[model samples]
Target: MRNVKVIVQGGPANEEVRTLPAHKKNPEVGDKKTVFSSHLLMEQADAESFGDNEEITAMDWGNAFVRNKKTNPATGKIESLDLELHLEGDFKKTSKKVHWLSAPTDAHPLIPVVLIDYDYLINKKKIEDGDDFTACLNPVTEYRVNALADANVEHLKRFDIIQFERKGFYICQGTKDAEGRMEFGFIPE
Candidate 1:
């Protein structure tokens, strides 16, 4: 038989969809995905050792954009974007970054704000206001209570998920309820 020539080609491998603990039931399909957009608040601080040497020179607060994708919309989809929350203007004079949580409750909306301090840095970090940073918002569902409980127990690190009738990615930050129930303050993105 006559000799035949063959060729091989390489291309980007297709990645399998990852399932987060939240979205384990009814996964989002096709173009049906949650798109979140919101204005975020950020702060910046100074870099120094202990003593009076530590001081904030600038402060800034501005709006930012946060985005994330939902591979499976069944269990729960938390925010997975890693964007620096920048603080400029008056904020720089005080601390680093701060995040707030907003959510609706039986009585009213739960809004809790927290101040984020820069404990340490690597390679002289650089950030600015009006700069966009990605953040995760937890989705609101029946599982929220359990999730928050786990979070309070330290079983979960951060509660970054958002759930609204139309909105997406939101986080929960604040104290527990009278029954030791954890409430979420969703930062819309």
Candidate 2:
């Protein structure tokens, strides 16, 4: 052969989908690609958990609650939900920028009321009116606040594969297995 010219060029290879663990904080979660099926660079991510090269794994989503202080028109009373629950272990990861959620400095405020009664409350789960939920650092956006008026941000029965597209990151909430536990995802996107 006299001569031949070839070119090999590309960015890092993307990973394929895989079954992530139900528990987010599982210590055995080694490398991300070692577990996660997808690893796209999150636009508002604080830092990739694995590293600049490795994508974060064991991601989760939840319907975080916010109790906006407001006076009830009918009663002219300020009835407040009085219980807050922060999952120390299950809240596997953290981030600084949550586009969907509104930070304190954001222009808008959270919905005046809990648009959808938490899944626990609807099932007669006995959530008291005076229940206090974790204070939302990133308040739910005005659009989300309004949308929630009709849209029920229901709970995912169990941990399932979450995906993202041009629209946004989506949590697939149809996991058949259930431990009968109710928890909210508080991390940022």
Candidate 3:
């Protein structure tokens, strides 16, 4: 299986961040000689959006390594571990970038949030003069996804607009409730 790389956000402010330097001579070897972290924290969710897909390089002393499982041929049981070199610069050729949210902790509690999206009220994009608009109305118009936002989301007020990375912009539906959960409606691009 190919390894996966993730860009993590939304956790404690004091969390560890690492950087690595790309090889100077060969621009293709790394990330165009751009300086970035060699050590990246491997994050997991309470319920992973994808299973066994995020196990790429794991966190350790300044070096990123992928764990390759060795299994016995006779019994098919796992036998040993093999480590493979995976650097931040190697992302161009082998890595798939996935976005993740770090788990909530007491130091940086996450704000519960619901993101709602809507289908077109009228299915047709443009209606001709003789077309019946009511017949084209969409019955199911809303889709909601429960998510956790960074602690800073507490500062958001009703009707405030915020951009969710890779998810587009959202408008705050209302203020946080007693349980510290709020709702946002997706704004189409």
Candidate 4:
């Protein structure tokens, strides 16, 4: 197993921190990135319609990585520790830069999941109009404009590939409601 590099969030906003240049590249790959961080605002995509790739577009999907390490109960040994999740797919359309799920591949590290919910609340308060939306995966989720019974169901139909439950995929779309604000949501299919 490869050594896993972890970047634990540190200190206060005012705290000074030092860093090495190599791991701080423009497109952080492997274990060098953070999820749901301020970087989310860096890639501002044009708001998309419901059930689209808004969240996907904002993400550095190509380089996204998940660490998988599990212990075997039989021998009480940890297996596959520091295993950086990987995807294997055909070179075909690789030039187009498709995600591992869409591309033809025997290695499917990210499986398509279902959309379980849309939005719940923040600090015991419901977001009145526009706020960043979140999802609960089953792997699945949805929104007001996005009904789980609608597009949510269809995205789970993995006709072309075998979607392993071990991994998951998230698709998000952000758009303005009748009242304008930055409202975003996570989609599970």
Residue-level lDDT tens digits of model 2 in 65-182: 2222233589544333111222232333432212121111122222221111112213234556665443312243322111211012233344432222123333333321233222
Off by over 4 Å in 3: 1-90, 125-134, 176-180
For candidate 1, write residues 94-114 as lDDT tens digits.
443332221123332323322
Segments of candidate 4 deviating more than 4 angstroms: 1-10, 13-174, 178-185
TM-score, model 3 to reference: 0.51
Which lDDT tens digits does candidate 4 get at residues 1-189?
111122112212231222222122533422221222111111001111112111112122332222333445895443322212123323332322221111112321222223223543433345445554443212322333321111122332222222111223333323334543222233346
Clashing pairs in 3: 18-37, 19-37, 19-38, 20-36, 20-37, 20-38
TM-scores of all candidate predictions against the true structure = 0.18, 0.19, 0.51, 0.16
State in Å the error of residue 17, model 4.
Answer: 9.3
Worst 10 residues of 1 by lDDT: 1-10
The candidate maximizing TM-score is: 3
Stretches of candidate 2 exceeding 4 Å from the true structure: 1-14, 25-39, 45-189
Query: Which candidate, 2 or 3, would have the higher lDDT against the true structure?
Result: 3
Task: In model 1, state the lDDT of residue 153.
Answer: 24
lDDT of 4: 0.25
TM-score of 4: 0.16
- The global C-alpha lDDT for each of the candidates, from Candidate 1 onward, is 0.28, 0.25, 0.49, 0.25
For model 1 the local lDDT of residue 138 reads 23
